[model samples]
Target: MLNMNRPNDVEAYIARAEADAVKIPGLENVRPRGIASAGVIGGGTMGRGIATALLCAEIPVTLIERDPATLERAIAEITSIIERNVTTRRMSADEAARAIKHLTTANEIEALEKSDLVIEAAYETMAVKQDIFSRLDRIARKGAILASNTSYLDVLEIASSTSRPQDVLGMHFFSPAHIMKLLEVVRTSATAPDALATAISVGLRIGKKPVVAGNAYGFIGNRMLAIRRHEAEAIILEGVTPDRVDQVVENFGFRMGPFRMGDLAGLDLGWTRDTSTGATVRERLCEAGRRGQKTGKGFFDYDDQRKPVVSPEAMDIIAGLAADKGIARREWSDDSILDRMVLPMIDEAAKILAEGIAARESDIDVVWLHGYNWPRHTGGPMHYARTLGLDTICARLKAMGRTPSDQLRKLLAAPQERQ
Candidate 1:
């Protein structure tokens, strides 16, 4: 049975949880290079957060932008953040002044020549990131650590743009980087031990929880998220409403459901108006200018104060898709809703573990708990699965006519091999 007690059970659970993290060979022996100064390319929201984090850790930062206006805007944003912290008592007056003192802004890539570590937090495209890495290869000081803040791009391909592939790694920070505690230290095949060490050390210095990830598309969290997204959309097509789905997930302890999250993040993230057709609900919504919360409309409509309510327009689109696809509609109970949504995530996590993309099952759990806001009371998805009994989950997957991944099957076949 699962232990769900508080305080009394917390310490023992934490001990077992920590033991679940897998250790990479030779990780302990590598001594990380000291970071005296850092460089952050791009002055967007993500770049500003990276620069602010370095400054807060007492490491000086040289932030580079493509033009003078953008550079100034980033500088102003950083300043405003510091001032707000002071006003809110998150930082004292003197501390805020000192943090500002350690920051410098530049418009040229060459200005980062002396930095010990330079991170590219530019646009999330191969062309843009490769161009930045190529420039850094020639300008950055010899032996400098080069990193990318890409959330989904290939780290190896980015490293190939630079001559020192061994020194290149991915330091993927969750959005709003300064506040988020999770830092995915993505290691490529050629990543030197010391490079990984430096990334881990820097993460720790900045008060972040660091987990090592292999060089795979979307790494751990995003890969599983893709599966969950597909399943969410599939169930909607079958009969479930967005509100019902959102409520079920929220009751399970998530901060928000997928549809609400999509609205808040904006449905227009990758959607281009010119290329959009009314084939899919999201595409149709974007085509109709129902982008997201910023526009006061999306899967849910917002009030004057921005509280969300169900939208008739969105329901109409969903109905249209259901009619076109000829999917049967039925009443979806909360249990079925929860199963359809979360089971795929567990399956994908199993595949990731089997493929060696994640070092441990708990590491995947950590990514979801901190980055994706999986409920802490549930002790992460993997632990929760164990609580449900792995055999029971496997049986349900089979009963649903789903083919379990090889790793999951093996794990089920061997009782002692379970994490």
Candidate 2:
């Protein structure tokens, strides 16, 4: 059996990899035009956050919205954020005033014409993005870098709408874009080398820890996150309660477990009224109108103040789903639960490494450390896997009755390469 505990020398290894994680590839040759001005489309939370970061970096920004009402709301929300930061001494009053002065709001897409860099933080749908990029292609000046703040959509498809595909790339920012340190600078096959360099330059300017990822669904962080979430949902259907699953994960050093995160982000993220089958726990919860923290209930119910409490209603739903699937109900040990949740992510990372979707294993670690809040001391998933030993991880996967990917098999064959 594989040892479940981390090796004693894990910290020493972490120290070494952390130094290599932040280096951007092909940066020395990148002589991107200085981004003195920027434009942000769709003045929602993400747009506002991106705009704020630009303003704070002393780059003037043009924030565009659909109409007068939304433009007003976006401006108000942005001003309030700056005001609060000033009040808390996070930004000086003079600095806040200067940032506010640097901001410009517009109700027309044409306003972005003067921007040296244009980031479309509009809705996530492909059609909406396609329309925006198509228009930007015409409105944006020659040589201006066009970026999409898309989380999972194909950047290549989005780039196709525009004639200058080389100028296009994905600048994926996590939620609360201003505060989050992780930015995935996704490069498509057609992305210009200078464009990629420009993105790395701008991302660092805004105080973000940027990592380069290839053009793929979910890229590096989200692709592996999907794997973890799939297994987490599966084990739930096999008898684990949401709270118990969350507890084991939280005990592993994550601030919040999967279920709690789902609740906070809302169960309705991907749920649609047209797809109302109630097949999964999330779909059923949405069908029941438990839209999560916003609605006071989800996988866990909330008190009036919105603190999560284990809901008997949620347990009943889980039990019914388990029965429907013909899975026997049973208790799970913390160790078993932790392994099931984490090992799949590690396996997926190995596959990502083999596929060259990420530059280095440490880059994947940087994505998780800053993007997903993986425990920093563990040195991200790839480092954690190294501590477990590739051979040991391969054996554990087989013992868990899971099929290891070919990439995993190859890694096991040359385990010394991992070191």
1-419, model 1: which lDDT tens digit per residue?
33644644534553455444435568768889878999999998899998988887778999999777888888998888888988999888898899999898888889999999999899888998999999999998888999999988899999999999999999999878888878888999999999898998898898777888999999988888888888887788888999999999999999999989889878887688788777777888888789889999998999988888999988888888889988888887898889888887888888888889987777877888878888887777776776676678887777666876777767445542324
What would the per-residue lDDT of candidate 2 be over residues 1-419, giving only the tens digit for each residue?
22225454555554454455446566666687778899999888889889888887778999999778878988998888888888889889999999999999888889989789999998889999999999999989999999999989999999999999999999998878888888899999999988998898898898888889999889999999889888888888888888889999888878889988888888897679897887887888888888889899999999998888999888888788778879876777888888888988888887888888887777888898888888866767876776777677877788668987888667545642321
Q: What TM-score number comes out for model 1?
A: 0.93
- Give the Cα error of residue 191 in candidate 1, in Å: 0.6
Candidate 2 residues lying further than 4 Å off, grouped into runs, are 1-25, 412-419
CA RMSD, predictions in order: 2.4, 3.0
Give the Cα error of residue 112 in candidate 1, in Å: 1.0
Estimate every model's Cα lDDT from 0 to 1.
0.84, 0.84
